[model samples]
Structure formats: C-alpha cells, structure tokens
Target: MNFLPTDDQLAFRDTAVRFAREKLAGTYLQRARIHTLDRQLVREMGALGLIGPDLPEEFGGMGLDYTTAGLMTEAIAYGDFNISYIQLLASLMGGMVAQHAGRDISMEWIPRVIAGEKIIGLGLTEPRGGSDAAGLQLKAEKTANGWRLNGEKTSMSAADQADAAVIFARTEDSTTGSNGVSAFFVDLTEKGISRTHFDDIGTKPVGRGSVFFDDVVIPSECLMATEGRAFGTIMAGFDFSRALIGLECIAPAQASVDETWAYIQEREAFGAPLAQYQGVTFPLAEAETQLTMMRQLCYYTLNLRDSGNSHTAEAAMCKWYVPKTTCEIIHQCLILHGHYGYTTDLPFHQRYNDVLGLQIGDGTAQIQKLVIAREKVGRVALQYDKQAKGGAA
Candidate 1:
C-alpha cells in the first residue's frame, strides 16, 4: 500500500533524471524530427544501465523492480518523448522474450537489447485490426526444422530499425481468434523479411511501419511459451507496459506545463505579466492537479504488477485515461503560450502530437472501458455472449 520510493528507487530515479536533463533535453527537438533514433545515444543510455534495469542481472539488467523501470521511463520521456519509446520497448518486448522465449534465445538477444546494441519490437497488430488482437491473420506453419512465417505486421513501432521482433502468428489453420496463435522470436535481418516506415506526424524517431515476412524461417527454439497457446500467456505482459505507457505520456505533457509556467511569468499582457492573469494561471494549475492524480494512478498500477497482484483493470485505466488526459493538458499548455506555441521553434506542438499517438496506439479508450467492464462483470459484459445469443436465435 505504501507507494513511497525506497532509497534505492530514489537513486535510480535521480540517475535517470540527471541523464535526461544533461544528455537528452538539449537536442530532443532535433532528434524528434529524424527518421530514426540516435543509435549512439541509445548505446549511451544502455551503458548507464538505463534500458531495462528490471530484467535479471544475468540477462544484462540491474535486477530492479518494475516501478524503477517506470520511473526511468517517465524521467527519460520528460526530456525526449521519442527516446523513451526505447525504454518502453526494451522493458515490454524484451521482458516477454526473457520470460517466454527459450533460455538460449533470451541469453543471446536480451543482453543486446539491454545493452542498447539492438532493439526488439512487438508484432501483434495486422493490416486488419489491432483491437481484435487475437484475430491475427499471419500464418506460421510448422516445418521440419522450424516454422515458416508468411504475413505482414503493420503499425509496429521501430518496425524498420528493430534488430528482432517477437511475432504472433496463427498456427492452426482451422482455429481462429486466440485459440491458435503462437509467438516467435524472429531476426528481422532474415532473408525473406522486408520493412517499411510510415510518415507519422510525431514520434518519427520511433518509426511506425509494416514488416512483411515472406516464407521467413526461424528455428524451433525461437518458439516462445506453449505453441498454439501463447496468445494469452504472452499478452499478460501488457499490463506492465500499459502502466509504463501512462508515465511515458505524462512526461511530455508535464514538460510543456513547466515551460508554459516559466513563459507566462515573463511574457507581458495588458502591461502586466501573463502570469498575473487568473485566466492563464488557472489552466496550468488544473493541469498540475490532473498530472499528479494520473501519475499516482500509474505508479500504483505498476506497484500492483510488482507485488504479483491482479492489475488488469488498473492497467486498463492507466492505458485509457492518462494518454487522453495528458494530451488535453498539453494542448492547453500550447494555447496558454499563444501563437508562439504553434511555431515549430517551441516544443508544445511536438509534445501534443507525440502524446496524442498513445491515445490510439496501446488500446483505444473505448477498448479499455470494455476491458474494465469485463473485469468487473466477467464474460457477461463482453460482446461474445450477445453474438452467441443472436446466432442461437
């Protein structure tokens, strides 16, 4: 119940904050516009043990708790939202690989991911839909030596740049939905794989794109968890990522608020500083209040995960609410800055666009609400029962 950070947690958070302020803040805008993240900077982060410190030290991490990872993600995002994507993926996708993938695979690739020498992306959403994640279309047929994968995964973050990916494919031809899906760790540089990047409005450095697999073959050892039953097990890791994502979205919005506070104090309006006007100051004050509440909720959710408690409902709440609310806060901060915020010279527009993506990416607000309802009332609250009843009629 106690959310207070121990001394060790505070040390990790302080290190991340110092790194972000000194190394990431100054060139965040410059880096944000780029097509790919700075590999050198990522390696720098890796060297400092900032990537996935929660993973076991045997796998090249510091063996910290999930809350520490969340704090690092939030601190990094405050300086550069795009760079924090690396932290998110490392902890989310990399953890999946470590826990589910074969020990050999985890040892070989995870260390690289933790070291920032490689990136691991998730392959779940297809061209058809993301929310119906279980209804994947990618095919993975068993082969003599391994599995042959043939399909396209779209909307993958860092799709083109990721060194490897944990892909979910439909393994049984006759079965559908979550029943027949299997997960695999595939090297992106495999012979039959091709990649493309999207022209997104924000998070350009963390590019979103499509990864096309054409009869790509991976060894059987790459298969993660129980074959044809990996969907539910592998996906449980998202509860951790959802909470981290809340922190990720909050940081940039907070940065914008901080900048606006300083701006209003200096800019004069009606022969007085803008800060003198209650109209200007009130919005920022309200934003601070919202940010504090959202932050506490996010950390509390992370704590639940760390404590081995059920957090599906809380994680969904963090996933759905924080991103949408923070985007609003950032937009308000942009308006408070007047026309100056609209210009590219300032970070408000970029922060707004970046934070806005999260509202749609992880899971939409509507989907999260459905998850919450299902958690509260079981299957009776889901659409499957209605569909079944209509079919029976």
Candidate 2:
C-alpha cells in the first residue's frame, strides 16, 4: 500500500546517488568500450552492504529486506546505470546460491561474496536458446566422480568478472521435456573453460560474454539442488530475478527523468526555459505516467516474493512492462536533451545505452508475453507455497 521509500532508505538512496555522480557519471564514456566492472566500486558496494544486502550478517551481509534492497537498487541506478545493473545482478545471483545451497556452501562462498571479494553471475542463455532456458543446449553429464560441463553460453553479463557462475545446463534425459535442466556452480578460472566479453550498448564493465566449458569438471557438492528439478529452480529464479530486473528498469528510467528535469529547469530554448514548451512537457509527462505504472507492477511482484506467494504471471507482466517502458523513457529523455543528450558530455546517452540492455536481459519482452499468455490460456500462475508443499523447489 505504501508507495514511498522510508526516510532511512531515502537517505541511503541519496548517498548512493551522490556517490555515483561524483564517482562514475562523468568518467565512463558510452563506448560500451569498458571491459570490466570496477572492482574497487564493487568493494565499496560490499562495504556499504549493497551487494547481497538481504543476506544474513553472519554470511558477511546486512540482510536487508527486499523492499529496502529494491530501494537501494533505485538509489545506485540514479547515479549510473551500469552500477545499478551490476549491483542487482550480483544480488540476485548471490541470493540464488545463498537460498538453495547448504550451510557449507554458504559458509565458504557467501562471506566472500558479501565482502566484495567475489562476484557471481548467471549463465543460462545460449546462442540456440535465448528465451528457452529449459532448451539450453549446454550439457553437464553426471560422472562416477562428479559431472562434466560442455557447452557455450552467449550474451551473458559478468562472465569475465565473476569468480564463479550459477550455470543452468541440460543434465537429464534430453528426450524428456523441461525436466532435463540442472544448475551448477562453475568456477570461471577452471581448466577447459574460455571466457570472452562482447562490446555492448552499455554496462560495458559487466563483460557480456560466452563461457565454453569443454569437459570441465564439477564436484558433486557444487550441484545446486538435484537433477531434473532445475526447471523449477530456474522458473522460480525467474520469478525472483525478473522482478529484480524490473527494479533495474526503474533505476535508469528515474535517472533519465531526473537528468532531463534538471536540464529543463535550467536550459533555455528559444529564450525560454525548455520546460515551458509543450513538446518538452508532454513527453516528460507521458514518460512519467508509463514509469509510474511500471514501478507499481515492480513493487507488486516484490510484495509477492516477500509474502512467499506465487506470481509467475505477474513477474512476466512486470518483466515485459518495465524494461520496454524504461527503454522508451530513456530515449524520450534523451530526445528532450537534443544535442546535449546525444553526446557523452551528459549522462543521457550513457543511460540510453544502459537501458537498452534491460529490454533484452533476464528475458526478452516477447518471452514474458508468451509466459503471460500461457498462464492465462492454460495453467494458473506459478504458486510458490503450494508448489513447495508439493516438493516443487
């Protein structure tokens, strides 16, 4: 019901914003040219308790709630888009490991992650299976010793920067349906693995790349949950990660709006403040309207998570709604800036590139719509509590 950030959250957000502007906004060019996320910044993020903020303190995390964590996402994003992107992705990936793995796994890895000592990224999308996670072509075959992974994941974020990755690969009888997926913890620096980063529109530091593991060894202990059940782990992960992606969308959208607002109040066009023009005002208003709607949906999905309720269809809806809306809002904000926005002189263009990635990351808008349609026309939305009671992750 409350649509506002708490006072402390707001203060934290302001601090993050100031830190971002002072630290990153002016320096990084939108070449999509950078190769790795700033480890120092990441260290600062860990020190601030932003990375895996919701995780337990004993694990070296602050264990903030989803609501507070979501607010922090918006705050970090307000300063620079790439930081927000990296921050949220790290949190979600770490959350998956912390949530599913045993105490031994948590004790060994969680503290390091919370200390900004390590980075975790997800690698599930393959060249052949962009939207179809269950159809992942990567193979992780069970062995007498442990398991062997062999395949390439494409267009993933943070491949090079991550100390480890949460990978979803085919393990069960491929003849079967979505039952074949199994998630694993693959060390990036392991033998028979090659990592490469691509030049992208934004979030250059996160290092979107391909991970090819050729007969790479994985210990049995590194397996998350059990075999043939990863489709549910992945599906539930989407429900959580997708909603978080919505917050990612919201952050850049807010940044674009804030920057545009600042420019309009000060910049004179035709001897009048730019905000005076209907052309400028109307688009801003329209963008705000869309962002408001998207933010509502984002919060709703987060609430579902907090309540331990199933809202898979809602996750799809927000995933589709927020990123697309965010992309649109960023461009509109840029258009208002005219020549200034188009240049790296202002952060508008950087935001434009940053927001571009969100539209496709996590899941494309097309995939989300299909999920929503499938839910409406066939089965009910995914149920977290009920499904868990039935032993469904």
Q: What ranges in model 1 sit over 4 Å off?
A: 383-389
Alpha-carbon RMSD, each predicted model: 1.3, 4.9
TM per candidate comes to 0.98, 0.90
- Candidate 1 residues 1-393, lDDT tens each? 988889999888898899999999889999989999999999999998899989888888888899999999999999999999999999998899989988998899989988999999999999997888898999999999999999999999999999999999999999977999999999999999999999999999998999999999889998999999999999999899999999999999899899899999999988999999999999999999999999999999999989999999999999999999999999998888778788999988888888888888978999889889989988764567668778421
TM-score of 2: 0.90
lDDT of each: 0.92, 0.76
Q: Indicate the residue-level lDDT of 257 in model 1.
A: 90
Q: In model 1, what lDDT does residue 118 have?
A: 97
Clashing pairs in 2: 37-205
Candidate 1 Cα deviation (angstroms), residue 31: 0.7
lDDT of 2 by residue, 177-227 (tens): 478788887778889999887877677877688888999998888888777
